[model samples]
Target: MNYEIIINSIASIGVILSVIFLAYQIKKNTQASRANYYDSLNKTNMEFLRQLVENRELGELLEKATSNWDNLNEDDKRTSNYLFIQLFRHWENMFYQHKLSVLDKQLWTNHLNTMIGYFHHDGTQEWWLKRKMAFAKDFRDFLEKTEKPKQIYPTIKDLTIKNK
Candidate 1:
């Protein structure tokens, strides 16, 4: 009887230790997953920014398209369309990530503010009206419901004028 009780206690302690170890591993994995996801998102954003930095013509086109889409020539308009598509697709991905709790709330809020700032431009709004359907319905609905700022965010042109 004494031997049986000693074995049962040992088994119980081993089971508890295994459960604790499993919980720790699960937590470690979750942290790693979140870190990996954030890193990927940052890399994607950097790639976009790098393109704008490395290609002066593309940067200029983006500025013009965001500020004056109607004034662009047919070819410029097509290029601008593709640019906006890529930009909005990235935003849509961020939106879904936030919805899935993969993205941090504060980070999502910052991104949302930037998105709203972009939308404050009439040209961006016009582009969205035409191309919004290309995105997922949920993302479209989220953007449609977002409140744009009353004042437009400063563009490169606006900054140039301010400097002068």
Candidate 2:
């Protein structure tokens, strides 16, 4: 009887330890996954910036499109349309990531502010109105409901100008 009781107690302890170990592993895996996601997101952002920096014509087109879409010729308008599509697609991905808790709240807030800043421009708003259906319904609804920031943000052209 004594031996049987000791065996049962040990088995229960073993089960508890296994449960603790499993929980720790799950937490670690989640952290690793989140890190990987952040890294990938950063890489994508860098690639976009790199493209703009490396291609002068592309950079100028983006500046013009954001500042005055109506001024662009037909071919430039088509190109700018595709550029906005890519930009919005990244924003949509960020939205879903934040919704899923994969992205940090502070980071999402910063990105949201940047998005709102873009919307402050007439050209950006125009592009969104025409292509909003290409994104997720929830994302579209969220953007539509968000109030534009009271302070106007600078455009790409403003940022590119030399201070001197």
Candidate 3:
């Protein structure tokens, strides 16, 4: 009778330990899934922004040129300004979501400053405005050159290997 009681106690403890281990595994898997979801979202956002910058058509440039700050028709000005602000907001969100470093932030700030200078210039007619637009195009090229490809898989695998 004593032997049977000891065996039953040990079996119960083993079952409880297994249950605890499974729960911990499930929790870890859940956290990893959440992180991957956020990372996918971040990558999608960056790709969308890059595509927009790359695919700006000539018609869009003409539209921007027509809608001058000084002489914009009210509705034209409103829409242009709204779009500009939204782009700026997206840029800022990307910067934070991607965990950009101080150097990256400085580079982005310089790009913004260049645009601001064009916006504030008093003599920005079609000729100078076109130059400014070219400047923007060049900046977009620079960003494309600088952006690192997403390497989440290899990075995570290396980390796991290191731990083991």
Judged by lDDT, which candidate is best?
1
| Comparison by lDDT, 1 against 3, better one | 1
Candidate 2 residue lDDT tens string, 1-164: 99999999999999999999999999999999999999988898898889989998988888788877877899999999988888888999999999899999998888889888886687777677778899899989988888877875676567667453
Query: Tens digits of per-residue lDDT for model 1 on 1-164?
Result: 99999999999999999999999999999889989989988998898889989999998898888887888899999999998998898899998889889899998888888888887687888787888889999988888887778776778888999999
**Higher-ranked by lDDT: 2 or 3:** 2
TM-score of each: 0.92, 0.92, 0.36
Q: Ranking by TM-score, best first? A: 2, 1, 3
- Candidate 3 at 123: error in angstroms? 29
Global local distance difference test of model 2: 0.86
Tell me how far the alpha carbon of residue 147 in candidate 2 is from the true structure, in angstroms, after superposition. Answer: 1.0
RMSD vs true structure, all candidates: 1.5, 1.7, 16.0
Instruction: Report every candidate's CA lDDT.
Output: 0.88, 0.86, 0.49
List where candidate 1 sits over 4 angstroms from the true fold: none
